[model samples]
Target: MSDPPKGPRVILEDDQPQIAPRLDFGWDQAVVPVVPPNPPSRWSGFGRAAAGVVVLGLGLGALEAANFTAAQFTRGAVQGWLTLGVVVAGFGLIASAGWAELRGLLSIRAVDRARAAFARGDLEAARSEALRWAGGMAEAAPLQPALRQVGSIAELRALLEAGPLAGLETQANALGRAAAVQAFAVTAISPSPGLDALVFAWRGVRLVRQVAALHGLRPGLAGTVALLRRTVFDAAAVAATDIAVDAAARALLSNKLLEQFAGEAAAGALAARRMLRLARVAAEACRITPPR
Candidate 1:
């Protein structure tokens, strides 16, 4: 029966609206937290104490020998005083070196603090830190007037970036390019793996030091080592993700012409890539503020 009116047929599809699947590569995830080092064990503490005692004992023995030797000199009293003066001077030099290293480390820490302050929008703290950082750069002198006019953290960063930082970046780029070329050439032509390793190490150290110096850092041996450690860790973390990309590019570029020198070309390219990465890392580490 045509019951009342044939109710309009209702159609229902089985599929619901599908949301585009979002791919999370973990890029937006919080950085992996660093595990704090274990506290020093009792044995470690005892070892350190024993080493200090041994050092003191050796120093005392050396002093006694030096005193006896001076006593036998023709001008015993004058010689003793001279020896004392020499010893004092040596200590003075050592103290000066230590102080320099400490200053360098503090300078690096100041850059870190300034970066953090600016990031948190603490304009007052940022201004103080910016001024302190600028004070160390002779190139920043002419930019002082403009810097004084900066009323915001962003403005301060902009001024520095367009001014002294720009020049420093240019110099750093040149240094990095030179180092990369040297690495490529050495790796391609080096006869022994040992020599290649030595050259790479030497160039890396020199490049890092030059970049650090360009950024107004006077990192001494200890400071340089610390900076190197940080740079290597950072660069390694970044490069790990890039290795597949680099390999793909290398494969695409391998042609008949390159095939003739394939081994050398691959080694050279890899070396250059690593050196460039190191240079970039070192430059970033020594920068007063994060790049825009």
Candidate 2:
């Protein structure tokens, strides 16, 4: 039976063949990974000045540490000798490193509190910090930060042509006029309710305007993530319009019905609410995105 089975069997065309995948070593791939360049840091002028001051301080520190150590060595006492030999020599290095670290921290801390507030999205705090920072600069027809802060209709037109803020210097000068137009429109409309409500709306708008001015509907430069910023602005504009319209219409309609039946006073309150909503939209648009 074994002998008979030894006869060759025919291979079937439909049978699966033995196979192995060729492995890729990937030796031909480029050695270096491609990565885009990082964006430049955006510190304020005063912040940059402060940064420079810290750097200058480092130079002074080296000489300062040595001089201070030398003075300690010259005191000429057993205690002084130990202070120089043990405490001064080893401790001096420790103290020097510690001092430089502390200075860095203090330098940042001195101004950083306000900047931190700005980061937390407080325009008032940022504006105050900006103005205070500007006050320290030499008077030269007001820098951008200064113009941005006290930028009443007058200063915006005059000092805006050129100055330190020349980075933003462009036909965007039209932005200043746009903001002024919004301001003027408000002034002309004169939405008088009373002293209390008036103050709240005014302050709210001012805060809104400050935020808008700094963050316009426009994005930043190319590769600056400007497009992303503009996308955010577009989203905000669309969302804001949708919200404002809904709120305003509802408020107006609710007030009309409420006054007709329930209470007339309720109508005015709702109207004020609607007015503020519109004002926020107007303020944000005025400051950030000019009507295109």
Q: Pick the candidate with the highest TM-score.
A: 1
Per-residue CA lDDT of candidate 1, range 163-220, in tens? 8988888888888889999998998788998999899899999999999989888888
C-alpha lDDT of candidate 2 relative to the true structure: 0.45
Q: Pull out the clashing pairs in model 1.
A: none
Per-residue C-alpha lDDT of model 2 across residues 1-292, encoded as one tens digit per residue: 3456776899755565566456677865754445688888789999999889977776576567566656766775564566457645665776676665554344234344544544454555555554554454343225645646653433433342245333232223444344444443444344554643565445444433333333322111221132223334554565566566656655676666653543333334433443344333433332211222
- Model 2, residue 29: distance off in Å is 11
Error of 1 at 224 (Å): 1.0
TM-score of each: 0.73, 0.22
**In model 2, which runs have C-alpha deviations exceeding 4 angstroms?**
1-18, 22-37, 40-48, 78-292
Q: Per model, how many backbone clashes are there?
A: 0, 6
**Lowest-scoring 10 consecutive residues by lDDT in candidate 2?**
217-226
TM-score of 2: 0.22
